[model samples]
Target: MNRCRNWRAAAAIAVAVSSWTGASALSQHKHVSDEELLNLLKDAAPASVFAGATVLNMAPDGTMKVVREGNNGWTCMDPSGTDPMCADAGGMEWGKAYMTKGPAPQRLGFIYMLRGDNGASNTDPYATGETPDNNWIKTGSHVMIVGAEAKSMIQSYPRSPKADPTKPYVMWAGTPYEHLMLPVK
Candidate 1:
């Protein structure tokens, strides 16, 4: 059943990807639709946040001071604010260090990047997350899990995958909140 759902979802993305035919055309639009937001949630925090989530929170540009609660005990903080992300309770703790202008968290946490991704810097914790960075390729469909060991998962793979939106790879390096970029593919 899970496999069937995965296939169906992938099919939908394939269709969506196909529809956004060219670079110029896709760029003209900000990709703001309920479907697009759901896709972002899936990529950013899939294991915790599911497709049937009752509410989809949008925290664009730091409008929400604190993480907003949702029906399933999930915390989402993005409509497009500071990298558009989501997290579970544990992940929220793990990501606190990087969430604001603070130091790295003492322990691990996680987050999701399903919505608008401008890709992220491997070395710069203060990475502006501005799009068009040749380095941090957009995470097509991926999740972030905070753990020092997570770096091993990142080291095992090539960085190229993260640079290409078509592929998947762990993001964040040389920083305190680095994590595993498990691909939904």
Candidate 2:
């Protein structure tokens, strides 16, 4: 279906956003075999989701290749190798907007990063590396709630720029792409 393909593309773009962030040794754009990449991305979400989710691998040059096809409306990827994630259509839209520094979608979106991340500056949404004032944090397995609904919860969680990443907190708070990050482990 065209809708399905569109969402897949969105998911690919979403994964690109993660890949563009902090560069860890593992996040480096190294050439990984499709089979190996698929295995690594399997941890991005639960088996139920991963079983039917489309999988993709992104190159350092920003190109994307489909590693697997699925019937489910979810997209999984691990371009950085260190930050595997599975995102739904809404989540993909949010990522696309965030990547372009544009307005976030009005609806809610979900993103799963059960394998954790390579670390990022909590205070600076676009921070590329750790710095004394950047509040760099490496979170464990977690999921994210994005878009307007998540923004509404900003007042319910820790929105401080230096909020702890190990707990439920608002990332990119007070910004158009602000979202809620919830730890699962």
Candidate 3:
């Protein structure tokens, strides 16, 4: 039973990594629900982690508006064209920086993007296509686990800011806001 459970988790991780890494082979994937996203948070961390967090909804136009408030200091986002993610206050700061293309801030933030729904292009920061990355090589599904400190901790990766299709890369690089591009698979 344990082995079976492990296998399932591994498989789930594989799919998640593929989905996040710009592989849109699973373009027919279903949209993730709020409850499922919350459950995914619980699965990723402890419920106490989100005791007082802020939830934001990121529109396709790159608009991030506040949805609600939590007791925890953490912040979560319901991003269009990708998986739901939760981040620390520092992560939120990094997000603001990313959105405004402002100076880098060393907030030491982290992000959890799991149980993905493919529509984002790995190359373009905001491609709304169902199968976003037409140049993906892996052709699988996955998710992203990122953080500023994780850049050095992990093997590294960077996102392409233009039409240049890129493979799995770091969330925000070149700035102190850089994060790890941890593909779940």
- Tell me, by lDDT, which candidate is best: 2
- Tens digits of per-residue lDDT, candidate 2, 17-83, equal 7533465433456656788888888888999999998777776665777777777878787756567
Candidate 2 achieves a global lDDT of 0.76
TM-score winner? 2
Better of 1 and 2 by TM-score: 2
Better of 1 and 3 by TM-score: 1
lDDT of each: 0.45, 0.76, 0.44
Compute the lDDT of residue 174 as modeled in candidate 3: 51
Candidate 3's residue-wise lDDT over 95-181, tens digit each?
Answer: 555545565455466655544433344344323343533332221223344444455654434444331223466543454444545
Model 1, 72: alpha-carbon shift in Å?
A: 3.9
Model 3 worst lDDT run, 10 consecutive residues: 133-142
**Per-residue C-alpha lDDT of model 1 across residues 1-185, encoded as one tens digit per residue:** 24334333222222222111122222233434455555555555565465432323332221222212245545543333224455554454454444443554545555565544554554444444444553544555556667564565567654542444445555565566556666555
What ranges in model 3 sit over 4 Å off?
A: 1-46, 57-68, 117-119, 126-178
